[model samples]
Structure formats: structure tokens, C-alpha cells
Target chain A: MSKALLYDATLCIDCKQCEAACADQNKLPYDDNIAKEERQSEHKFTAVLSKNDKYMRRLCMNCQEPACVSVCPVAALRKTSEGPVIYEANRCMGCRYCMAACPFGVPKYEWSSLNPKVRKCTMCPDRVLAGRQTACAENCPTGATKFGDRDELINEARKRIQDNPANYIHHIYGVEEVGGTSVLLLSGVPFEEFGYRTDFPRDPLPLRTYQVLSKIPDFIPLGFVTLGGIWWITHRREAVAAAEGRQAHQAGKELK
Target chain B: MKIKFTFWKAVFLLIVAAGAYGTFVRFFRGLGASTNLSDQFPWGIWIGFDVLCGVMLAAGGFTLTAAVHILNIQRLKPIVRPTILTAFLGYVLVSVALLFDLGRPYNIWHPLIMRNPHSVMFEVAYCVMLYTTVLALEFSPIVLERFNLQKPLKVVKAVLIPLVLLGVILSTLHQSSLGTLYLIMPTKLHPFWYTPLLPVFFFLSAIAVGLAMTIFESSMSSKHFGRELELPILQELGRVLLVVLTVYAILRFEDLLHRGVFHQLLVAGYERNLFLLEIVLALVLPLTLLAIPKIRQSAGGLYLAAVSVVLGFITNRLNVSITGMETAAGLHYVPKWTEIAITGAIIAVGFALFALAVNYLPIFPEHREAAGPEAPVAAKAAVLSHAGD
Candidate 1:
């Protein structure tokens, strides 16, 4: 039931409609200068990059189990059941652990503002919840950037590769990357050629930190008991020695 | 009370003034304007040096308290007060520096209520808060004695053993948790520094640096205050440092070997060179200097060994936090001058406050009392009387 976005690189005709629509949907300033930039920033939620006569769109991967959400001390970021990882600005203390933890480097900070907030793709949660397509999906001239149920998109991507094996790559980029992101991609060329990280672990990144954090409950009690035991033994030994010395002094006084 | 405008004091004042301006720019203009930190390089020396190294260097507070209070090594009691003060000051400075680094400095208290049990950072935050409180309590008896508040002093004294135990436990948790912060960055962190045993490495290195810092502080204070150097105790600390450095070196290399990253040591690269430098400074130099009995027994030699260990500790932390991530980040992050100024200012404030505290408080035992072998007995009697009261 979770919604997902499937981006077909071969179908994208360098139209740049998705970029315009995303900027519009997010209420970010979109000008010629901002539009021409090939990077996602606080001012630009999504961007389209052109290389070797092929186009690819870049935005937040919105992982099923987000590293950002796991690392955030304040729980400002959370993964919604509907497939989008959302952030609450009011809850964020701006620790930027999210910025460091994100494997995709998707989160951008409003570093220029006195009161800054981490900015990234929200995946149009409102539109997805209302049963409407995202702005980028609605504005795409071709069916390049399609929004639909994640499982159906996976099926649709598999069919596209099966139908035209010669035209598309055999692999789906997001099907297993960082434990399967909501955003899926189909590329004619290798995903890495489009500057995508293909080296991500198939397992979720949050599990790595969880493995360490889970041991704390066991550690606290063990450490406390050991320290307490040592303090008791040492204090008892001191008291015993002090008592023996006092008895010897009393015996010496009686002998005199 | 007249302040002397000595050469170094004047320089310190200048740095603080520059730091004040940097702080203004940071608050008004934001991190982007003041630092070179970008999305690719989210953390700089603020987190690396000011927070990481600051906390590490302050490990002496727990280590010494544990030694004296828990282990019953009462010979170390004379030096415990100053070490606690340094730790209290160090933690306070770290909090101050974090305010400058955080994007939303005002919302620092959010972690207190908004719980994220899964986050290592959350663990670190809670431990730092709790440990700072424990350190304040551990240090309160000195303040109480200075003000001649007998009733409160007795209350604090009665709880001293439990308080010291709590301090050690808190230090152990956070010191290791700091390493856990980087456990999530396995792909990004260089293999030379990354391992599952990172928390263990962090904890062990913290203990070693804790001892080294005690010696370094003792040496510096002896010279500054025109007091006799506590050579015997410092020499004993050096011997302990030798044992710790040896174990640390063995485990570090063993971990590298176990991970099949031993070959990285032979590679001619920036990371390898930095790794070698860290080992040489942190392990080899201190071990060599402290192993020789004559050198270990000498005040100057012991001081040099401690300084080397301290420097090596700093190098290791910086390498782990900054240098290790450079290739993956795709750029070398050189901290802006404003960032350096702020860090410098924080250190200067620590020194200024320490000097003021030493002048006002009974941080060190009286020369005659410290010189006597009866000092420990006197201290025990004082504690017994407080308990009886």
C-alpha cells in the first residue's frame, strides 16, 4: 500500500519538468540560475543531471529504515508507513547527525540562515495521501517519472526490462540499495555512471548502529556491580586495617 | 586585586577578543558563513577537536577518582581535586563549543525530553549531562571547605564514595559511546581507523590519556605555582602509562591484522602516513621514554613522555574524525580561521578559569600536609569524623 516513485532514465527526454514541478510543490525558489544547477540544495529539492546524452533525476532516496531517523537524538525524522521519510522542523535541534548519517548525502542544511533546518525531499506526502500523483509525476511529459504503489512499480520495472532487455539495464537501482528505498530507478547505463552510489550494503544502515546501542542495557548493570563490589571490598579492607591499628595502640597504652 | 598584563596574558586576551568576534559572526551569520563545513563535510574541528579531544583529555577526572576512591590508592588523593576541576571546566567548555557548532543551538535541551534510545548520540548526551552533574558534586567539597560550609561539606563527604563510583560508570559509558557514534560510518570511515572494536579502542585510549593528562597537568602546575614536582607519583603514572601504551598498541595492530587491513600500513598514502604518525606519537615515543627507569624517574623525562602521549591522543582523534573521511567526502576540509579562533578561545577560557580557581580554591593540599606520610591517615580521619557527624 506504500507509494513509490519509479524513474526511467531512458524515457526521460531532458524535459526538466520534474525539476520545475518539484520546486513549485516544495515552495522553493526556482529561477534560471537555480534551475541550471545540477545539485540538490536547500533551495532546490530535486535536480536533473545530463551526462553522455542521458538524463537522470536526483532526490532523497527515503529509505525504508532511514539512518538519519535512527541517528537523530531528538527523533525529528521518522519513516511514515506510507513510504515517505518525513522531518519535523520544530523537533529538530539542528545537531546535523542526520547530515552525517545519511548514506546518500541527501539532507541539506540551511547553513546560511541564523535559524537553520535540514531540508530534503518529503516525497509529497500530502499528495500521496490524497490519492493524487506527486507534482513531478503529474508534470512529466512522458511516463518517465511514474508514481504508484511500490510493489506495482517494482513489477512494472521488471516488465520493462523483460520486454526490452536490449534497451534497459537488467538491474533495478533501489530494489536492494540501503535495504530497498521507496524511490526506484531504471537506467540504460550503469547507475554509477549517473553518479549514483552502487556500493551500498543491501542491509539497512541503521542496524549497524543498533548492534552497538543494544548492548548498553547489559553493560550498565555489569559496570555498576563491578564498581560497587570494588568500592565495598576496598573500603572494608581500609576499615579493618584502621581497627587493627587502634587495638594495637590500646594494647601498647595498657602495657605502659 | 590587580591583574598583571604579562606577554602571554596579553596574547590570551587578544585570542579571547578574536574569539568573541567569531562567536558573534557564528551566531548572526550562521555556520555556513563562519565555517568550511558543507553537506559533504558536516563536522569540522568543533566536533573533532573541541568536543572529542576535550572530553578525552578530561578522562583524568574519573580515572583518578576511581584509583583513589574505589581502588583505595590513597597516595593519589592530593592530585584528585585539580583533576576534577579540570574535568568540570573541560565539560563546561565542550558544552559552550557545541552551542557554536549546532545549527539550532537554542534547541539543545530537546534531547532531554525527546528520546531516541536507538541513537548513540542520545546516549552520549545523557551521559555527558549526568557525568557533569556528578563531577560538580565530586568537586563541591573543595568549594565547601573554601567557604567553610561545614554542614554541606559533611553531607557531600558522606556521599563521596558513591559519587565517585557513579562518575566512573558514566565516564565509561560516554567515552565508549563516542566511538559508537562513528560505527554507523563504516563505508565512509577509512579502514585503518574503522573496526567493530572501535568502542573498546576508544575506552582504552581514554584511560591511557587520562593517566598521561594527570602527569602533564601536575608537571605544568608544579612549575607555574613554584611548588616541588610530585616526581614519585608522576613516575608511577609513567610506569602505568607504559603498560597501557603497550596493550593499546598490541590491540590496535591486532585489530588491523584481524580485519585484513594490515596491508594498508605498508601503502604509501596520506592515511597510512597519518596512522603511522599517530602510533609513533601515542605509543612508541611514550613507551620508549617510560621504559627506561632512569628516564621514567626524572621529572623532565616523565613530563616529555606524558606530553607525547597527549599529543598522540589528539592526533588519533583528529585522524578518526576528519582525516579518515576525506576521500569519501571528496574534499579536504580545512577549518576556517573563524573556527580555529573559536576553538582557541574555548581553550583559553579553560586556562583562565583554571588559574582563577587555583588562586581562590584549595585545589592542592598544603605543602607540609602533602609532604607527610600521615596525609592519607589524616584524610581518612576527616572522612570518619564527617560520617559520624
Candidate 2:
């Protein structure tokens, strides 16, 4: 079963226990400053922002068709079947194309390191593979962040919304945006109020690039034939002109 | 050859020295210390100017080779060597700048072995690597002749046509692929610059800038090296420039109108103003100057128009890479002094190397004919020796 995390903004208490659990699980250093930070960074893979008297958790969306995965020149970023977008640090050339490509802007670079690596939420790939819950979900005090099968979670989210329509917005954020993400969100207010991009296309972002890239194979042969034909005709014309000039010179010499 | 310790040379050396220090700092302390780049703006001038503008500016190589070798416009032959040399050096410097910009410069070759054809970046990487090699091969004849290596020269000459064809193909792929790099970022990029026709826009502008660079280089060489200007050829090029600029302008506005982003131009803001400035510098200025036969005929006027095109090309690329994304990024980005220093050093090295190459090699045609009645038999012989193969 493909795993997923459902984050309910109304239920989050902003106690930051999930943040602490994420830092601990990832073995990243955390402190007062990191706790106060509302933005995800190389050190902070996840953050909980306070907006409109509600706490919203920010992390990698782990898209079904990840833009970062597609744009990585060296296959450094990959979308695992376990519903996580993982990074192979060894494979990364540090081109940062992934950083630029991520619509959510989730990937953060360790720019201060001489040998830098892109840092982002892995959704606890190891634990998920071991049939265990992610640290954030495991440590959530209020069941605000729940991890389970993606399909079941979507059903649960729909049930909650259908059961109480007035308490929740009509839209489910990650269901269709950028062709669906592993992480789903339920918010009482509009997602745009919390600085989420509400304008993302319904289709996967990589499709846009592939639309142009797919034509390159056809373009290559056509380019060669056109260029080669031009070369042949022009060179042949030059050769014929040179040959006639020689013949003309020979005839003139005979007359003399 | 003796070196001159002129004031300009001193300045060049200082900038290079500063750049070397910046490089050292960049490698040791990492990109965070050397640049103002952040998570929001992962790319800066190094990618925009050094890599993007650098590659586009070097388009002169494929353009001239196509004209002279494929199209049989032998009149442009005199400037081909210098143009190739500029391109070779431009690509080499772009690679050098990539070292400064890439977080792991040592692993730059990963793209070669770890192939991802789906990525536009992957295609760009392959094209740049392959085209740089092609440029090197295209440029080797000059070096071979200087050393009097007959055997290898014959072999290279025999394959020159195929090599030129390959360069054009590769140039076309990557020059437009640079624009394709932004296609995936439709949400991030502003609509004014974002269109499905980005690749076409990029390809067209590269050609225009390529011609402009040729004219610019010719004028610079004539003024500095005390060589006679190739006025008739440049005048002819100016007319071509006019046509290309007109087409590019028409297509660009048409794209904007078609995308229904033409109204964005009416909105008073930084992006709109910058767009206007880019159009004026890149399109309007050059088009107006080149359309006038009197200005096109004059060397000074032609130089001014070419410079405008070059500057405007720089602006356009920068706008696409930086300004277009700034509003979406929700923050302003400015390159650090170290970033500026390194960029300056790279350009300075290009100038220094070009001067050295010109001083040492047979970059210009030996015979002097300023569009004189007499046929340039010697110059034609030099070019035909390669073309005949």
C-alpha cells in the first residue's frame, strides 16, 4: 500500500512535538532558533507555521509525479513506490535543478558545506519500509498528523469533510494539485491564506518539459537532412561553376 | 611575444587576481559564503550571465560556419576564424563559471554517466559537453596550421563539413533547450516571458545576437588591432540584423498578445518597466538604427547598433532567469561582490585570451582587400583549402 500523511490544520496545537520528532528521527540538530523558524531549511526538514490562529505544518509534498525527480540531471532525486521522494546524496552533482524545479520549494541546499547535499523531508523511508509509522505521525500528541494508506486517508478526509462541511473547506489540497501528492492537507481557511500556492496546474509539472523534449528525436534527423541537403546543393553548384570556368579557359587558350 | 604592462592590462590582472581569491573562498567556504543565492533564488548571475548569456553570445560559431560552409556565402569567410575562436573561448569560460556556481563542481561529469533524458537540464548538459568538443575540433585547424602539422590537418579538413553540421545541430538543440529549462516552471515564471514558444524565442534571439556579436567583434578588432574594417560585409550583416530583429519583435509581441498577457504590460510595475527597457535596448534601438541605410553603412553606427543588441540580449536573458521569477519568489536577489568579481574575472580572462590568440595565431585573413575590385585570391585560397575537402 502507498503510504501518506494527512495533516489537519485545525487539530494542530502548535506544540511542535512533531517538529522535534522529525529532527530527532532525521538526526538533525535542533535548538530554540530552529524551533522558532517558520520556514523549512537544510537543518529543518519540516516547520509548523502559525497563521490566522491556526498551525499549519510545512514539509515535502512527495508528489506522485515529482518535478524534482524529473528535473534531476543525474537521478539524484527519485520518487519511491512507498510514497516518498528520496534523495541519493552520492548521486547528486549539486546542480540544484531540483531546488529550482520543486513547485512547493521543499528542497533546501546545505550551501555552507564544502560538499553540500540537498535536504528535504524523506517521509521516514526507512521506517515506512520497515512497516512502521513516520516519526512525526508517531509522536503527534493530538493525532493532527496521521500516517496510513493513501487511499484510506483520502476516504477518511472526505468523511470528515462530508460529516462537517462548515468546519472545513470544500477542497482537499493535495488530491489534484500537481497531479496529486502523497501528503494531503485539510484546512478550515483557504490554503492561499497560509502562503500555499493555490495556482498550481492540475497536471504534473514535468509534462511541460517532456512536451518539448519528446520532439528532439524527430528534430535531430530533420536538422541533419536539411543541413546536409543545403551543403550538397551549394557545394555541387560551386564545383560545377569551377569546372565550367576551367573548360572556358581551355577553349580560350585553343583560340589564341 | 612580448607582454605589455599597460594600465588596462594592470586592471585586467587585478580583476583576475580578485576572481582567483573569490574562487578560493567559494571552494573552501562553500556557495553560501561566496554568493547571495538562497533557497528562494538558487540561481544568480553565474547561471544567468556566465552560463546563459555566455552560451547565447557564443552562437556566432555555428551561425558563421553554417553561412560560409553550408550556404556558400564566401564573403563572410574572413571573420569565421575569429568568431570560432570567440565561441571556443566563450564555452570554455562558461564551463569555468559553472565550476564556481555548481555546489559540487567536481561531480560535473555525473550528467554524462548518469543519464536522464527526460530532464531538459540533462539534454542541456549533454549538448554543452558535446558542442564544446565540436568547437574545439572546429578551432583545431588554426592551431594545426600554426604548428605546420600537415597530416592531421588533412584529416581534420576532410571531416570539416560533418563537424560543422554537427556543431549546428548541437547548437540548435542546446540554444533552444536553454529556454526549455524554464518550461517546467510555468507557475514560478511570469506569464509575460513564459509561453510554449519559449524555445522559438530563445533560438531566434540567439541568431540575432550571434550576428550582432560578429559585427561587434569585427569593429572591436579593427579599432584595436589597426586592421581595415570589412565594411561591405558588415553593412550586409546590418541589413540581415534588421530583418531578424523585426521578426523577433513581431513574434514576441504576438506571443504576449496570444497568451493574453499583453495587458500586464499596461500594469505599472518593475517587471513591465524592465520589459519595456529590454524591448527598447534589444529590439527597438537596433531595428531603428539598422533600418537606416546611412547608419548601416557607417562603421560607427553599425558598432553602436550591434552593442545595443548585445546589451539587450544580456538584459533579456537576465530578465528571464532572474526578474521574471523575483515576484513569485517573494524576495529580491542581488549578487554579492564575490559573485561580481568572479564574473568580471571570467570576462577579463576571455579578453586576455582573445588578445593572446589574435597576437599569436592567424585569426584574421592575411590579404587586405577592403571590398576592392581585385579578387582576394590568397584569402579565398586559405578558406577553399578547407572547404574543398
Candidate 3:
């Protein structure tokens, strides 16, 4: 089953137990005061973004059709069949287009290292594959974060919104955004208030790119034929003009 | 025969020294120390200027070659060799700058052996590689002649037409592909520079810049190298620039209108100001200047127009790569002193190499060769027979 995470902002107390757990799980240094160090970084794969007295986790959404996976020239980043988008350091030449392409701006680069790699949440694939929850979800103290099969998680999230219609926003954050992310979120207020982009097109981003690229086959032949025609016409005209000038000069000499 | 120790040379040396230090730090301490690049701003002026602006500027090579060799514009032949040399040097410098920019410079060849046809960057990598090779091959006849290697010259000459055609094809592919590289960044890039037809815009603007660069390089060469100005050809180039620039300007406005973002142009902000400045200086001013017959004919007028176009292209590219992404990055990026020094050194070294090539090689066809129809063939045959000895 494809694992997914459902994060409910109403339940999160901003304790940051998940942040510490993720850091420990990934072997990165854990910060004592994570609220002061809010955004996700090279060392912090997940962080709770505190805004307007509300808390939200800021990590890779791991899109169903990730722009990073689509844009990586060497296939360094791949969305695993089971779930989660994973990166292989061995194949990465560090172009960082992945950093540019991620809609959430989730990927971070190891800029300070002599050999840098793109850093992001892998969604704890090893733990998930072992039939255990992700480090963050497993460590959550308030049951704010939960992990299970994606379809079941989506149904569970919907059930919460249905049961607490007055308390919840009556909408799932990731069901249709950027063609659906594996990580879903339930919020008390609007998602845009917490810096989440609510204006994305429902279709995957790469589909738009593929639509443009699909026209290349038509463009190449047309461009070549057009360029060739211009070259031929211009050269033919010049050649004819030169020939006429030569003939006129020879005729003038004969008349003289 | 003697070189002078001038102020500019002194300045150049100081920059190279500082840049050498920066490069040292870059290799040792990595990108974080030498550049202003961050997780937020992973690309800086090194990409904005060195790779993007550099490749766009070097476009004169394919454009001029296509005009002369393919379009049968015989008068433009005098400028072709010099333009190609400049382009070859420009691409070489771009490659060097890219090497510094990549975090794993040693694995640069991964793009070559690895196949990721779905990726736009994959296409860009292949095009850059193929086009650079094409340029080198296109440039080799000059070196062969300089060395008086007739047999090799004959062999290279046999393939010259095909090579030029291939070079033009490859140039078109990558010049447009550079824009395609940004297509994935639709949300990150501001709507002002981002359009579905970005590749079209990139291709069109490249043609304009390519032509303008030829005029700019030619005029500069005439003044500095004591070569006579091919005034008529330069004047024709100005007219062509007017046409191409007009088309580009119209397409730009049309794209804005199509996207219903023409109102964005009126918004009171820094991006608006920069966008307006880019349009006025790069497009409108040059177009107005080149449209006048008398102004187009005058050397000064042509030079000014060409310079404006070149500057405008630089601004457009910089805006697309850097300024457009700034808002998305949430914090602004200012290039470190080291970044400036390294880029300056790269340009200084490119100029020095160009000067050296002009001094030693027969880049400019002789005055007699410029006047005579058969001069290029005669000169090559002479070099060939000398090599036969």
C-alpha cells in the first residue's frame, strides 16, 4: 500500500516533537529551539511553520507528479512506486533545477559543502517499507500527524471534516492542488493564510510542459524547411543577378 | 611590437588576482563562501551573466555565418571569421564559468552518458555540447590555414557547408531550449517574463541580439584594429535590426495581452520599473534609432543602436534568470564581492584571448580580399600551395 501522511493543524500544539524526531532519524543535528529556526533547511527536513497562532508542517508535499522528478536531467530524483520522492546522490551533478522546479520550494542545496547534494524529505521510505510509520508521524505526541495507506488517509481526513463541520474548513488541502500531493492537510482556517499556494491549476505542472514539447516535432520540420527555403531563394536570386551582370558586361565589350 | 603597461591592464590584473582568490575559495570552501547563492537563490549572476548573457552574446557566430554562407549576402563575408572567433571564445568562457557554477564539476560528463530525454535541461546540455563542437569545426579551417596545412584544410573545407548548416540547426535548437529550461518554473517566474511562448520569444530575441552583436563587434574591431568599416553592410544590419526588434516588441506586447497581464505593467513596483526600463532601452530606443534611414546609415548611429540592443538583451536575460525569481525566493540576493571579481576575470580573460587571436591569426580578411570576389579562395589556395612546399 502507498503510504501517506494527514496533518491536522487543529490538533498540532507546535511542540515540534516531529521536527526533533525527523532530525534524529535523518542523523542531522537537532535544534533545541526550533520555533526560532522555523523554515526547513539542510539539517531540518520538516519544520512546523507557526503563523497567526496556527501551526503547519513545512516539508516536501511529495507531489503525485513532482516537478523535481520531471525536471532532473540525470533522473537523480525519482518518485518511488510505493510512495515518497527519493533522490540518489550518486547520480546528481548538482544542477539544482530541482530546487527551482519544486512548487513548495521544498528542496534545499548543500551550498556550503565542497560536494553539495539536494536535500529534501524522503518521507522515511525505509521506515514506511518496514511497515512502521515515518519518524515524524511516529513521534507525534498530539495525534496531529497520522500515516497509513493514501486512500484510507484521505477518507479519514474527510471523515474528520464531516464530523467537525463547525471546527474544520470543510476542505482538504492537497486533494486537487498540483494534481494532488501524497501529504494531505486539514486546517481550521484557509490554507493561503499559512503561505500555502491555493491558486495552482488542478493538472500536473509537467503536463503543461509536455503539451509545449509535443509541438516540437511539428516545429523542427517547419523551421528547417522554412530556413532552407529562404536560403535557396536568396542564393538563387543572387546567383541569377551575378550571371546577368556578367552577360551584360560581355555584351558591352562586344558592342565596343 | 612592444606592449604597454596601461591602467586597464593593471586593473585587469588586480581583478584576476582577486578572482583567483575567489576561485580558490570556491573550490575549497564551496559555493556558499564564494557566491551569494543559497537554497532560496541557488542561481546568481554567474548563471545570469556568464552562461545566459554569454551564450546570447555569442549568437553572432551562427547568425553571421547563415547570412553570408547561406543567404548569399556576399558583402557580409568580411566579418564572418572574426565573428566566429569571438563566438568560439565566448562559448569556451561560458563552459569555464559553468564548470565553476556546478557543484560537482567532475561529473559534468554525466549529462553526456546519461539519457534523460524528457528533461529540457538534457536537451540544453546536448545542444551546448554539439554546438560547441560545431563551432570548433567551423573555426578549424582558419587554424589549418595559419599552419599552412593544405591536406587537412581540403578535408575540412569539403565538409564546411554541411557543418555550417548543422551549426545553424543546433544554434536554433539550444537558443530556444534555453527558454524551455525555464518552462518548468511557471509559478516561480513572474508572469511578466513567463509566457507559454517563451521559447518563441527567446528565439526571436536571440536573432535580434545576434545581428546587433555582429554590428557591435564589427564596429569595435574597425576602430581598435584599424580595419576599415564595412559601412554598407553595417547599415543593412541596422535596418534588419529594426525589423527584428519590431517583431520582438510586438510579440512581447501580444504575449502580455494574451495573458491579460498588460495591467501588470502599470502596477507601481520595482519589477514594473525594471520591466519598463528593459522595454524602453532594449527595444523601443533602438527600434526608433534604427528606423531612420540617415541614422541607420551613419556609423555612430548604427553603433549606438547595436549597443542598446546588446544591453537590452543582457537586461532581459538577467531579469528572466534573477529578478523574476527574487520575489519567489522571499529574500533578495546580492552577489558577493567574490562573485563580481570572478565574473570580471572571466570576461577580462576572454578579451585577452580575443586580442591574442587577432594579433596572431588572419581573422580579418585583407583589404584586397574585402574588395575582390575571389580573394578568399585565392588566399586559401596560396596557403595550401605553401603547405604543399
Candidate 2: tens digits of C-alpha lDDT, residues B1-389: 23445555556668878999998889999999999999999999999999999999999999999999999899999999999999999999999999889888899999979988999999999999999999999999888887779999999999999999999999999999999999988888888788989998899999999999999989877766667999998987888889889999999988888889977777899999988889999998988898888998999999999999998989999999999989988999889999999998888778767766775667888622122324322332222222111
Clashing pairs in 3: none
Worst 10 residues of 3 chain B by lDDT: B380-389
| Per-residue C-alpha lDDT of model 3 across residues B303-354, encoded as one tens digit per residue | 9999899888899999999989999888888899889888888887777677
Candidates in order have lDDT scores of 0.88, 0.89, 0.84
User: For residues B214-296, what per-residue lDDT tens digits would candidate 1 score against the true structure?
Assistant: 99989877766566788888877888888888898899889888899987777799988989899899989889988899999
Interface RMSD per candidate (angstroms): 0.9, 0.7, 1.6
* Candidate that beats the other on lDDT, 2 or 3, i.e. the better one: 2
Residue B197, model 1: Cα distance from true site in angstroms: 1.4
lDDT of 3 by residue, A107-142 (tens): 999989999988999999888777889999999999
Report the lDDT of model 2 for residue A192. 86
Model 1 misplaced regions, further than 4 Å: A244-256, B367-389
Model 2 reproduces what portion of true contacts?
Answer: 0.84
